[model samples]
Target: MEILRLDSFSFRYPHTQRCALKDITLSADEGDFVLLCGASGSGKSTLLENLKPELRRNGERTGEITCLGRPLQSLSRMESACDIGFVMQNLEAQLVADTVRGELCFGLESLGFPPEVIRRRVAEMASYFGLGKLLNRSVNTLSGGEKQLVSLASVLSLSPKLLLLDEPASQLDPVAARELFSMLARINSELGITILLAEHHTEELFTLCSKAVLLHNGQVSFCGAPREAARFITQNRTLSSDAIPPQTKESGSAYVFTSLLPSAAKIFPDEPSLPLSVREGRALFKQKISGRTPPAPMPVIPPTAPPAVSVTDVYFGYGSKDTLLFHDLSLTLYEGELSAVMGANGSGKSTLLKLLCGLLKPKRGTIELFGKRGAKPTLGYLPQNPRLLFLADTVQQDLTACAENLRLLHPEERIQSLSEALGISDILSSHPYDISAGELQRAALAKVLLSSPRLLLLDEPTKALDPFAKSKLAALLRGLVQSGVTVLFASHDTEFCASYCDRCALLFDGQTAATGAPAQFFGGNVFYSTAAARIAAGFSYDSVTCGEVRNLWIK
Candidate 1:
């Protein structure tokens, strides 16, 4: 059934000159999984917000929005509950309770649902969403992916028929992302729930969303099949931010995404589509080349030292896991080296980072950064949930809020430069809560950079960023590494691991499966290897970074 419809919708924010939604019309039937794909600042979220009036503030609208033949404005707040369930990008913004069980019952309780009914629905939703284990855990203890699931389950606890997910999987790990989407698919299939998801990645969504809609600037530009959208995006490389629908697709190792990329990137694997960022994708492609192993080029480093970081017998994990994160996991990161740690979700990759940053006391292991221990390591750790550490109000304040002893030297210079590079410069004065998730992350990164630490620890650094931001971040990390700094990041994007990092360490089931050259290591793991990497004969030493592969080709 066609559950929702928009007719000539046009909207503009009070102070803005440009219309956030321009004469837009769209429709989705129950059981249809529709995706709104686009870049950051695109109208995907704006359009999604239109479904709920609470999401808007003193906005002007000239068109009609109808849900089940009734005007959107006329539907009672409680009626919309059983109809459309909207999930915003920022989970915390929507979360209301301290504990997981409390959060699940919030919406149901608001409606005065019977206690027994709430209990039944909550338990069912928790088990169905794989959140039963987290029912008693504090909301603060959950990871990004876990929180997203909790939010989804909480929404489901209300028994809504239509699900509106905004950038839903942007913060999830690969395995969890896949599972979450799969669950959504089943809900649509069995329960007849109509799903409309707005996201940056589109490749995976292509197969899931029966119909695709691309909003450009604020207008409906491409509304058609996934394959057709993919062709349109691939052919038009010069789409303006306002003229093209945001699209991202998984092509190979890297996500080939842009306003021009297909919609699969955001859908599958929770990876972004490369908007012409093929450093890692190309590197993986080159690795498959067989005939003769190409000779390696002269080393980029000028006869530099061997390495900077060394970890031996690293063992760490949560209670009752019955295994170390990495038993006998040994690896070293050379100075001026950029390495990516790749693996499926829950691979203890984050734990490995904790050991390196001294966030966790290793159970039975030793870690040496710059050949030292028991000292404040020069490592800058970017935790998965950065917003928790934020105490200041304004973006500028957070970046420069520290006192003399802890203050960054010349923070203004670094903040302005890094902010512009990461595309968060315009919102420097805005409150942290007012900005986009992508913008906040960039701002946090700028703050981290201000400290000028020698080693950077990034846990899923690319979670909510768009292609442009991702490219800038990659370049910035590269620049840092070239300037004698080192980076060790955990990520699910195989293309990123291949293109930027000098090496890759694979983690699985709370242990390091392999640590070596990305190109070589990726070749053996189906979950880690890129499409091009698999197609290419094989990699030389699991080398996944583009510079390495390009030099290897040249030689």
Candidate 2:
């Protein structure tokens, strides 16, 4: 049965001329797992928020919405609260309690559940989500991924029939993201709960989703089975000029959306059928390269460049009583290099960046910037939460302030160039908080670049970006590196690191476990590698990125 339905729904935020969602007619059946996907600011989040009345934005809304055979707006507050659950993109925004246990019990208590029942539900959620050890831990000390899990558990404790998630795995590592997806699948299959998730990371989800919906410019471009949706997207790129929409054609939305597909889909777009997973991709790859010789391995060159940032036996921790998060940690970043620091959640990736940017001082170690022991060099740092970087109300104002404060020459030209490159030119007049998370990330990056820092440090730089924006960022960073700037970023995006970064460092148990070239680093790992590497591995190929695999196949 259809549990929810919308008939020609339209919504426009206050003070905005364009509707955020336009003529959207959609439905979700009971126990269905629907995948919502689109480019940044494409109205996926807006639609999701509109479904939950309590969280819906103040907007000019029109049309009919039904839930369980009744009007959505007619449902009682308690009924809606108990039937629909939402997990927001920002993990910290939803968490309320101090400890994991308390957070799990918050929703239950709010609804005035019996103490015994609340206890039972909390225990079950904690055990099910593997939060047993963290139950007593402070929520403030939890990593972004851990906090996300806690928020999910808290929502699940309410036993809602329908779950809505926005980029739930954006902050999770590969293994953890896989596990989260698996858990979500089980919830849909075993528990019979319907799920509608909006996410950019569709590699694993593409195969799991019962249905996929693609949105573009506030409209449903495609809504069908996942496989059919994949084929439609790939096939649409070859359509005639008149067949495509003018705005879409000009923006190359087809190409941008194609990049959001799975690596196998991207690599074999013209195939009779696209493979959705690495296993199937490997099988197809083996057949394609059956009689062909593998490409020669790329040479590994040792770095002879001077050090840009050096850390010697660093020890650091948060508060006075907190245990040391980093002990005897040492690493070096050479000039004109783009390096990535990757590790599991709570493994100190953000902490290491903070130390390098002088936001946090090491307890017992030496940190030198450009061969000086205590010198402070010009640098740009983008934190995990892009909202923290915003000082002015509007994006345009914030960027202008940044450029002016830095005494940049020709500030208007610089701002305009960066805004266009980062795809934030249209939203410059909007408030910084009004834009999408991905848009906000790019805006923050534009501000950071306005400084023209010699060294750049980023924490989770690709947290909410789509594939097209990532490519733009990669090209921008490449240009910076060519101009003799050095960059060090911490991320959980193994695919981005493998494709664009020069070196990858793995941090485990408070120290650098391994650091080497991307090919040698990700290619050597089993679970921590990209899908392209895993697919190529079947043919004894060491290709770690889709570009490399595509180039080799072409050759």
Candidate 3:
């Protein structure tokens, strides 16, 4: 049975000149796992919102939309809200309740579900998604990943017939992300839920989704199998995969772990498709090494200068709760380094970053920058959300303002060089929000580049990029490394960490479990690589980049 159908559906913003979704015709049958992918602003959100008609405003709409046999346009707000569960792109904005329990129960209470029923459902969902422990926790206290998961659980508790998810796992760590997807798959398989997820991470999504739809510029460019859409996007690099009909790549076999890479342990998988992520690669490698000989890798640390970034005797937390985010934690980052901090939700990976970037003061101990310790630890910082830009009316104005700010202090630089390099030269005059997320990320990068800092601290940098955009970022990071910049990035993309990073640090229980190369860290231990890496299966002299792995073949 077709759970929902859209026929010749078209819509535009209020009084807008152009259509936001033009001739958008698509359908999702009952119990189908559908992946809706497109570039930023490629009608993905528009279409998802249209799935629940009550969300749409006074926009010009035509054609027929039926949801569970009801006319979509005529459905009441309450009915539609109950029928469709939406987990939006910006989780922060959608969150309404003050506490975790309140947020989860708010909707159920409104629907007049028995308080006992709501409580029971809330408990089930909380435990199911690991939120049971944080029931009384304040919503704002949760990290990006926790908030997202909580929001998702809140929606899923409704048992919606159609679930609309826009990058639900975008801000989680690799372990958390894998767990989320695993849960999603389990729910889809068990609950007869129809899921339409718009995402940027294709590697894992491809394995999970049964069908794929690529949208570009408010139109459906292609709708088919995951492999077909992957090929289409790969071949076409000129257009954003989600926005325009993408050209599939002819020969590149890279996955997109833009900011991460794993170790090249001497364990290889005897499988069909080699893994492209650390977790997947390591799993396969583990299988191969089992009942067989394990190859030893040479210790990667060199007998040279001291570690690049070192934290000693650090104790930190917020208010007086004694959260003890980091308890006397000490670590070292060697020179010419690309290191990552990995942990589950609320493990203080980000808090540690804030201390390193000089944004927060440590409750105890000291942090060293390149060889010195102080309040002014010179480092470049890119927050998870790039919301620091001044409210300039136009994109050109934003750039000019950024350049001007950098100029007033340094007075010895040029904008054309960095702007061109970052590919933001063309869109220098558009509104910041009007631009795509990828472009906004790039522009933010360019702005940070202007400061010419020696060290870079990035928090979940690949939140919303598709595979191609992610790969481009990985290449750019590699370039920065070659240019002698050190990076301390936090990412949920395990492949990114396993492939590009020289070392991996796993933060757990207010302390780091291990800190070493990807191979050493992921090999023969509780720590794991990504699914792509596992699928790649087996060890090569070098593991492929976390984002991409090509077969060692000429075909």
Q: Compare the candidates by lDDT and give the number of the best one.
A: 2
Q: lDDT (CA) for every model shown?
A: 0.69, 0.86, 0.69
Each candidate: RMSD: 6.8, 2.9, 5.7
lDDT of 2 by residue, 1-555 (tens): 999899999999989999989999999999999999888898989999988989988979999989878998998888888899999998888999999999998888998999999989989998888999999999998877788889988998888888999999888988888888998998899889999999989989998999999988889888999989888887766432111111243754455577678888776667887787887878888777878887666677888999888888999987874798899898887899999999999899989988888888899999998899988888999999999999897999999998888888899999999998888999999999988999999999999989889999988888888776787899899999999899999988988898889888899988989988988888788988989888888554468877666555656
After the best TM-score superposition of candidate 3, give how far the Cα of residue 94 lies from its true spot, in angstroms.
2.8
lDDT string, candidate 3, 1-555, tens digits: 998888888988664577878898888899889987766556777788778765565678888889888788677777777779998877887789999999999889988899899989999999888887888999999877788888888998887888998777777766666677778888899888999988775556666777888776678877776655555444433322112222343422222211111122112222344343456555654554455432334466652646678899898888875567788888888776778888877888778888998789888998988788884544788887775754787666665676687665543344676666655676666667655666677777766766777788888777676655555577777778778888888776766676668788888887777887776665533325654344444543333332232332201
Candidate 2 segments whose C-alpha is farther than 4 A from its true place: 238-253, 320-322
Q: Is candidate 1 or candidate 3 better by TM-score?
A: 3
Q: Give the TM-score (vs. native) of candidate 2.
A: 0.95
Q: List the residue pairs that clash in candidate 2.
A: none
Models sorted by TM-score, best on top: 2, 3, 1
Off by over 4 Å in 3: 9-22, 54-64, 111-132, 143-146, 227-307, 375-378, 408-420, 424-429, 434-437, 524-527, 532-555
lDDT of 1 by residue, 28-76 (tens): 8777888776555557777888887666656789989998778889988
